[model samples]
Target chain A: MLATTIHGPRDIRVEEVPDPTIKRPTDAIVRVVAGCVCGSDLWPYRGENPIQAGATIGHECIGVVEEVGGDVQQFRPGDFVIVPFCHCDNTCAHCEAGVQSACDNLSMTTSGQGELARVGQADGSLVAVDGGAPDAALVPSLLALTDVMPTGWHAAVSAGVAKGGSVVVVGDGAVGLCGVLAASVMGAETIIAMSRHEDRQRLATDFGATHVVAERDRAGAKAVKEITGGVGADAVLECVGTDQSMGTAFAVARPGATVGFVGVPHGVELPVGKMFQKNVALRGGIAPVRRYLPELLELVLDGRIDPGRVFDLTLPLADAPEAYRAMDERRAIKVLLQP
Target chain B: MLATTIHGPRDIRVEEVPDPTIKRPTDAIVRVVAGCVCGSDLWPYRGENPIQAGATIGHECIGVVEEVGGDVQQFRPGDFVIVPFCHCDNTCAHCEAGVQSACDNLSMTTSGQGELARVGQADGSLVAVDGGAPDAALVPSLLALTDVMPTGWHAAVSAGVAKGGSVVVVGDGAVGLCGVLAASVMGAETIIAMSRHEDRQRLATDFGATHVVAERDRAGAKAVKEITGGVGADAVLECVGTDQSMGTAFAVARPGATVGFVGVPHGVELPVGKMFQKNVALRGGIAPVRRYLPELLELVLDGRIDPGRVFDLTLPLADAPEAYRAMDERRAIKVLLQP
Candidate 1:
């Protein structure tokens, strides 16, 4: 099998690697069918985070079960499944509360290189698709359910976007575009996607954003306020984790509104006094993607949401390094890799 | 008229001061019947906060309307009323949402001394004592409603102490003791009061606390977890605004629960990462006392709650500086002054 590895900053390579095998009773060995480049992957890719000599880089994936361990009862060989970025045993109290990202057994990659990927305490980590391997068209949708789509959904829902709320989505990344779609599906009456990129903004608009403004902070907030009858948006989805985006999200929301953030926070500090005075809530983290997979799959299956639209480029697994570069350079909104 | 002033940290004086008169359209002059010392006041009383020399002190009071401005319509000149520590117009969006502390025209303290108070936004700041001029038995309760008592109620309620939910009240002061009562009134299945003082703990038990513990942090959180079948309390009212107290509240709450905090945040800082992981909400700031006045007044009038029990010490208005000293020295659980 082939896997992508990061050698150093901006240095990505695809090479032959040992195929993964089931190790735990609850585990299922899945042969990767498709994986996509994630915005978070760029953290180490851009050297913002330390990178090991070689590390298995992808988390968002749709795969076929190659084998199942003895205790695995929900899935079988040849079944299609989606695997989330954060692995957890589904029965823990935190997982039960749908906060898998904070699951007691949750694991993350540090300055370590990968070996055979082990889905720890797998029962809650993998969501299986019905029956046989899924159709080719469903690949991006399945991969998305594992992270980006559900993450976008979490951002929208956690911001407490109601049926008729005016929502402002910050970030023009794939996840932000997906958030616009998620807000629309959740019945948001007005969706504003803040974007500077033409292609990404188009995706946001197509995803149901009623408006787009290539602005942030005071300017973006002012535009949103004007559009919202002087009351800011009811909810703001912060897909970018920087302090600037968080501030923009906070400033663009009305009193009693909330800001849902799915991006991994880095150097972001909350202004407690303002949040308290405005009565704004901060919700969302590494979204419990697994929790929303089933419902999201239904939406995708019913043709109600086409999350795959976020993918602007797709390459064979052999070109994973190029895919990373394309995304890192902002040349591709999302890169779908066939494995 | 006589007034209490903070000459410096740990220094106070009781002396003659000019009498207050209505100064705004919404103002009401009250001949204070009773007033009490507050824990927050000690921030300045202890010299922790920068208090100007000889600044008038007290904020809580219950009194008879001595005069009213042209627009004061809630009470007649002879009516008795409760003055919430922070006056609000009650008609602002925040006030309409029952968040009086965040009202657009937040009141600044006008009367600084021995009870006679000039309350701004009179209609919203004053709650009429319609059952008649309150009796001596109701005096303390009315004063309690002016600040600490209602603040405690707001803490318990914001913590989402649903009927039959298990609760933990942190803090040994009057507000914490009152929180135990508030939780009991809200029908919590078990009320655990965390206090070190035997007298305060006894008062907590008398006020319906099911259990009392002196432990805090992990020990206290562990004890509370054990008491709640190892799942932690359903609601934790943090009445101490210190970093440790906030940590204890977060550690002792079950997933998806709320930590209601009424203690004026001091050196306290929220553990944002932990809060996000726990999915526990931090709600309730300075209590909107006026918002709860109506309901609390009914409870007091109906003989369902005796918040007066928190007033363990009573002194002549002329000795308010001594009351402040006793409280600052931790010699008095709460001190009341009769004007």
Candidate 2:
């Protein structure tokens, strides 16, 4: 089997690897049909995070179950499924409480950008597509439900986006664009997207952003406030985990508003004093994509949303290095890889 | 008029000061019926906070309206009112959103310990007791609504305390004890009070704390976890603003739980990483007491709750210095001053 691996900064390669096998009775061998590069993947590619030499990478994918362990009851061979970025038993206290990201028995979905991947907790982690695999055109959208779309939905829910509420989405990455979509789906009356790049701003607009602010920092918050009639947004989605983005998210939130952050935090310090004084709340973290998979999959399959448009570039799995480079240099919003 | 003034650290004095008069059309002059020393008052008393020489200090009180300016509509002379620690116009965007603490035209109640105090935004800041002044025995409870009780209610509401949920309160001050009462009113099934002091623990048990954890830091969190069957509390109230208290607040919160904080923040930094990873949320600040005044006041009037029990000591107006000293020395949970 061919799998993606990283050796060091900017070093991505697709090489021959041993095929995955059912290691436990609750495990399944998934023949990945589609996998995508994630924004977090850049952390190691850019050396921002320590990398384990030649570690298998990628956590988002849609695939067909090639084989299943004896204990896996819900999924079987020939079933199409979405693999959540994180695996959970779905029965633990936290998982039962809808916080599957903090499940007691949690594991990351590594080796998804490969010909075959072993999925643990198969009965609880995998959400199979009803009636088998659908049209090829819907693959990317279905693949999105594995991580990004649900993450965006989590951000919107965490921010408490409600009908008739105004929302500000910080960051223009795929997740941020998805946040705009989530807010739209949640019936937010006003959606503000902060993006400096023209292409991302256009996508943001198409994804239901009523206003786009190309400014950064204070100017950007000022722009959002102006759009919200000088009172700031009713809810804020922080999709980029940087101090500047977090600052803007908090700054543009009206008193009693919440900032739902889905971005993996990096060098971010919360403004506790300002948050307290303004009665602003901070919520969110690793999204419980597994918890939201079933509902979101229905939305995607019903064509109510087209989150797959985020995949601006696609390539064969053998071109893993190029995929990493494209996302690393901002040439692609997100890259889909066919295995 | 006699008022409490602070000249420096440990310099609380009962001194003659000019009586308050209407300074704005929205102002009402309140004749103090009862003013209580707060936990926050000790900050300057202990020299932890910089003192402004000879400044009038108390901010919690129930009073009778002595006079009202032309624009004061809801409150009139002879009406008794609860003066919220923070005053707001009640019609501003933030106030309309139910976060009066962050009202656009916000002010503080600074002269409540005096014979007469001027309250700005009178129509918004003063919640007049219906049917005129009530029995004297209820004065202390009405005073509690001004700050402590509503603040505790805000913490519980912010933490999303729902029926049958479990709760943990991190501080043992009057506000924290009030938090125990708030959680009880909210129908939390298991209320854990973290307090080492026998007096406060007794009060906590009386206020609906089903369990008392006398440990500090890790041990306290451990005890809470044990009480909650190792799943941690569903909601946590961070009533003390110190970093250690905040740490314990976050430490004992279950994943997807919220920590509602109301204590004046002092050198507290949030554990953002832990919060993100565990999906724990942080909310609350200077409470929007005015928003919650009506409901909580009704509860007190109905004798369903007795938040005023937190006022364990009483002092005459001339004995203001002793009141401050008793509170500073932890000899009283809270002190009520009659002017």
Candidate 3:
């Protein structure tokens, strides 16, 4: 099997690796059909995050079960499935409470970019597609449910995006665009997308953003406030975890509004005093994508949403290095890889 | 008129001051019936918070309406009312959204411990007791509603307290004891109160704390986890605005739980990484006491709750200096002052 591995900064390669096997009774061998590059993947590629000499990378994928452990009851060979970024038993107190990201027995899927990957907690972590593999055209959308789409949905839910509410989505990356879509699906009447790039802004509008502000920092928040009729947004989605983005998110939130953050925090310090004085709330973290998988899969399969459009570039597994470069240089919103 | 004034740290004095008169069309003059020394009052008295020399200080009070300006519509002379610490117009967007603490036209009540106090936004900030002034015995309870009771209620509400849930309160001050009462009223099955003092623990148990943990820091969180069968509480109230208290609030919360904080933040920094990984949320701030005044008033009037019990000491108006000393020394849970 060939898998994506990183040796150092900007050092991505697809090299031959040993095939995965069922290591536990609850594990399954998945023959990955599709994998994608994430915004977070750039952390290591750009030297922003530490990395080992050589470690498998990638956590989002859709695949077919090639083998299953004896204890795995819900999934079997030949079934198409979506693998959540994080694996959970789905029965622990936290998982039962719908916070699978904080599951007691949690493990992340790191070899998804490989031809074959081992998935643990098979019965609880994998959501199989009914009736067998669908049309090839729907593969990207189905693959999205494994991570980004569900993450965006979690941000919207955490922000309390309710029917007839106004929402401001910070960051116009794929995840932020998905957040705009999620807010729309949740019935938010006014969706504002903060973006500085033309291509991303267009996608944001197409994904249901009623207004797009290309300004950054204070100017951006001022734009959002003006659009909201002098009062700030009813809910804010902080999809970019940076000090500047978080600041804008809080600045544009009306009193009693919540900011749901999904981007992994990097040197971000919360404005506790402002949050308190304005009665603003902060919620969100690693999204429980597993909990939202089943529902999101249904939406994708029914054609109610087309989250796959976020994938602006596709590359073969052997071109994994190019995929990383494209995302790091902002040449693509997201890159899909065929294994 | 006699009023409490602070010249500097440890310099509380009862001095002659000019009587308050209606200052604006939206203002009302109230003759103080009862004013209590608050946990926050100690901040200025101890010099932890900056204070101007000879400044009148006090924000919680129950009084009879002395006079009203032309624009004061809801309150009338001779009517008894609870004056929220923060005065709000209650018609602004934030107020209409139930966050009166962040009202567009907001002001703080600074002369509450005086014989006569001028309250701004009278129609919005004052919640009068129906059918005129009640018995003297109920005055303390109504006074409690002016700040502590509603602030505690805000903490519970912000923490997402639900029926049959478990709760942990991180402070033993008047507001924290009131928080225990608030959790009980919200139908929490298990209420844990963290207090080191015997007197406060006793009062906590009386206020409906099912369990009391005397440990501090890590040990306190450990005790709460052990009591909750190792999973942690469903909701947590952070009543002490310190780094240690905020840390414990998050430490003892179950995954996906929210920590509601109401204490005036001193030097608190949030653990954003831990919060993101564990899916814990933080909410709450200067409480919208005016929004909760009506409901809390009814509860106090019905004798269903006795929040005023937190005031364990009473002092004469001339003894205002002593009231401050008692609260500052932690010799009294709270002190009620008659003017």
| CAPRI-style grade of the A/B interface in model 3 | high
Clashes of each: 0, 0, 0
> Candidate 2: where is the Cα deviation over 4 Å?
none
Cα-based lDDT for every prediction = 0.81, 0.92, 0.91
> What TM-score, computed on C-alpha atoms, does each candidate reach?
0.92, 0.99, 0.99
lDDT of 1 by residue, A175-287 (tens): 99889999999999999999988998888889999999987678888888888877678888999888899899888877666788887776777776676566566766678
Better of 1 and 3 by DockQ: 3
Model 1 spans > 4 angstroms off: A104-117, A229-233, B110-113
Best by DockQ: 3
Evaluated against the true chain A, what TM-score does chain A of model 2 have? 0.98
Candidate rank order under TM-score: 3, 2, 1
Which of 1 and 2 is the better model by DockQ?
2
Task: Quote model 3's TM-score.
Answer: 0.99
Cα lDDT tens digits, model 2, B121-193, are 9998888898887898998899999899999999999999999999999899999999999999999999999
Q: Better model by DockQ, 2 or 3?
A: 3
Instruction: Tell me, per candidate, how large a share of the native contacts it keeps.
Output: 0.11, 0.79, 0.78
- Measured as a fraction from 0 to 1, the native contacts recovered by model 1 come to 0.11
Span of ten consecutive residues with least summed lDDT in model 2 chain A:
A108-117
